[model samples]
Target: VGSASIRPPATAGRRVPQGNSCNFGQGSRACVRLRGHALFRMAVRNAAPAVLGNALTCHVVAGCDVAAHAASGDTAGGQARGQAWKGLILRGWLRGGLPCGGQRCGSMRAGSCQGSRADVPMHGLLNARGQRRRVLVPPPLLLPLLLLTLLLPTAPPRCAAATSPTTRPEPSPQQAAAARGCSAEALLPLYARIDDDLRHWAAHGISEQLMDKALATQTTASGEKAIGVLFESGVPYVVSPLEEIDRLGHHTGLITAHLRFFEALRETFGPSIPDVEFIVGTADQPAIRLDRLENGALPYPLLRFCKSETHADVLVPDIHFQMRAFNATLLQQLDVINSVAWGEKAEELFGRFSQYKRIIHEHIPTLEVHGAGGENICHHANFELLFCDVREHFMKWAHGVRSSGAPVDVARQPRIKMIDHARYKYLLHLDGQTCSSRLEQLLVMNSVVFKEESGYHAFYHHLLKPGEHYVPVWKEGPEDVLEALKWARAHDDEARAMARRAQRFTQNYLHPDALACYWFTLLGRLAQLQRFEPGRGRRAYPVVLMASEYLGSNAGKAYVQKHGLSRMELPRAKRVEQRRA
Candidate 1:
């Protein structure tokens, strides 16, 4: 085998770090050496070179044949598993050479030998013509995380213990408001669109007619799954997206997070947030005012928030995505609850899945093979023939591995375990693709964030102070991260102190009560922009139930029942009047 393999690969001569192990091969013979413990057994069949794109090269592994691995015996699920593994291998999911010796011939250090294909290409990802090709791998594949998590019979106990009921009592709005500063001044910029919409709608005067016009426009804006939620007396109905979620969904968990966000606002602020029908979409987009396309005046209100799982930070904080990182990997198995706060629980989870704990128990005996090095896929990094961006990043800085390999991009990028992020002294937060969701999650990880400067920001960006909450990094080029890395290594204490400050800011200001208060204040401002009364709309759920259609199951009903919020009294919107800004 040559250079094509998983990113952050088990390099040749790199001993399987003892402690935890990953069984990655399919064979009766063991090629594993984790402090000399027999861990993974894989029998690779040698076949023809796998074809990548026209220019990218693929070399044949000595004994690694996709056809044989897919066709037969010990590697179960015959055709299905075979095709799956074959797809993984061919797509460059697992490639590279192994560290041959020891387990195969009782010699601790043996040279590379042929396990299968006699014509194994030891040089590079070269072709028949010997032309070198450069191929940048896609982000990491998600199948490995899914495959590994399924191996756990049940998740370790959630931050909340089910029996004793780790759920905490809800803090009163008055109590929370009294303890925290309730200034809406810092947050007004977060809703600049609301002001723009209001100025536009004021000229039109009729909210009813304005909505009728807006709804017609929305209908044609990609007729996918868009449900509008008319908030009558603080009770939420359902909403719309632009031409994303792809336009119906982006991930069901995010939709639930936003719906529940409205529910939490209703819970904390009562009906003071006026009756308004909002086409609240959960996407990495800006608030939509259809009129922006027309006269730039106030039209029907709509907001498309990035809606990270942590946006639960804007409201409940209990329906957290980070607790189990449920949204990223682990499927829809969100049957998790944190008895403690997510920030605190994160520390525990990090240590629990610590890359240090994977102890692989091997059950197969090694078969003595002739002439083959029987390397354990680690030796494949030698050929500097092809270029890899991540490999280059690693070679240059020699620190800062990608922290969220499991849930985020796992392929082209090298990754560490989900919680291993805490173990990293410094974490780089780049606004990937758009304003990244990584910033929110990283600040809470107790590591210094090398936050790259970006124009995009969330509603809560006002709270972060550069040099206080994070160490700023210039995002001008690829080496921006490299620059930040050198600075942190030079000034260690200052970076650590900033991380402490960020942790304090998150824990003190990001409480469920404080976040709801932020939403509560934002809603009042949101309604001020509405020119017409928002009372006329279809009812979805009573303000008292708190159960949304998005809740999806009886477990939500039970959660509502247990929390004492289900039947909490609601302040009628018809009564309270808000002052015009």
Candidate 2:
């Protein structure tokens, strides 16, 4: 039989129909309103699983029906039955059976089984009717099951305890220290190896011997010892019997002796020594013996050599006819010093140093000369005094000029005018304006030289007149050195300022620390390559050093081809002359 209930009565009565409108008033006629049957149908569908689940629960717990019934409905019998059914459904869901609503049961059932169902008494659904047929569901079961339905494991709430910061494992102090030590150990070996190689090179004859000698003569014990070995053997002293004997012959024997010494040093030192460099003059042709070597064989401390000229060329107009000629000559002298000191090319080294000195002489007055006589001296003597003073002034000027990027042309006229007025007057009218600090110094230095010519005014005037040849007089004095020092001290503040500016400029563009970092990074890359691939080593290649102006010149290309080196592999060549300096 279907369960039925009576509908509640309405207060108002129905009215009679008038024209087209008819009103059915409340309570006027017996109205039979159907209670919502759809809800009952859904409940029946949901309850079927619960009923089946209850039957299974009855098998497990026969007396728990009273509690289930009470929780499911208000009536004692029904509540007891419903409660028992609810308990059964929960148990079934826990065991992976279908839900009470026939949905697929999930992991939520595990929590449901572990909830507070045991606390609720089974007899609580009994009423005054004394009906014991209904099931009484434990209150805990109903509430926890309802929660389980909402809080199922399909999307379980994140466990705060699991994610809490306190649960994370902290690193042990010993482990952290070990890690740091490992990093340091890895870095230390690399740096140590590099330092060891450099030291080996220094201990052998790789460093400049003449430089070593100069340091030995001028510096402390440590400095002297720092390059002592370099000076002892590999270097050929300029005044040696070999130099006299060889004269115009090939210096290959000298070079080969040095190479053999280097080879012996490397063999004695084992793998630490990298290679030996032999710098020679471009005109010098060394003996070549390619057939003596085997393929893939390491040549005992491989030989790397370069050719550079170190002496001043009289034929080069740029050096001979340019401004600051005397200053240029002095610089040429320094090149001789460096070559003797550093085993540099004679002509090339001299040329660059001369150029540098000329620049400096044109800008600063570090050297000066004074005559024994006053303004009343003969014209020739006065001219000599004037020429010496001008030469001194320009020498100092050139130092300052060379330190900057100024052109070396501006100081020529004043240089020539002060030395011999007649030969170089044509240069005076050309480009009167000076644009650089170096140029300004050149002019100021020239002014000082002009002042020194006061005694030689008549001779200079006569020489300046058209078609008269000017004969330069040369003089030497002790006070000139003091005068040069005074001039240097006077411009010391400006020099310091320029030096600071240059330092700042270098920091921005050519910082040594940044360069070190780059080198270290490159080293790391090389190390990585070596580690990843064994047996593959750095290739032996020839390097060509050419002047910047000659880099793209045909002669330079020809030289590259002659050496059997690829143009592509060529590093941007710095001036070999500059390197020597």
Best by lDDT: 1
Least well predicted 10-residue stretch by lDDT in candidate 2: 311-320
Runs of candidate 2 with Cα error greater than 4 angstroms are: 1-257, 260-269, 272-490, 494-581
Question: What overall lDDT goes with each candidate model?
Answer: 0.38, 0.23
Q: Estimate each model's TM-score.
A: 0.43, 0.15
Report the error of model 2 at residue 23, Å: 99
RMSD of each: 30.1, 35.8
Tens digit per residue, CA lDDT, model 2, 91-175: 4311112122222211111100111222221221112232332322334534464345334433311223332222233323223
How many clashes in each structure? 32, 59
Model 1 stretches astray by more than 4 angstroms: 1-206, 218-221, 224-226, 239-250, 287-300, 306-418, 537-581
Q: Give the TM-score of candidate 2.
A: 0.15
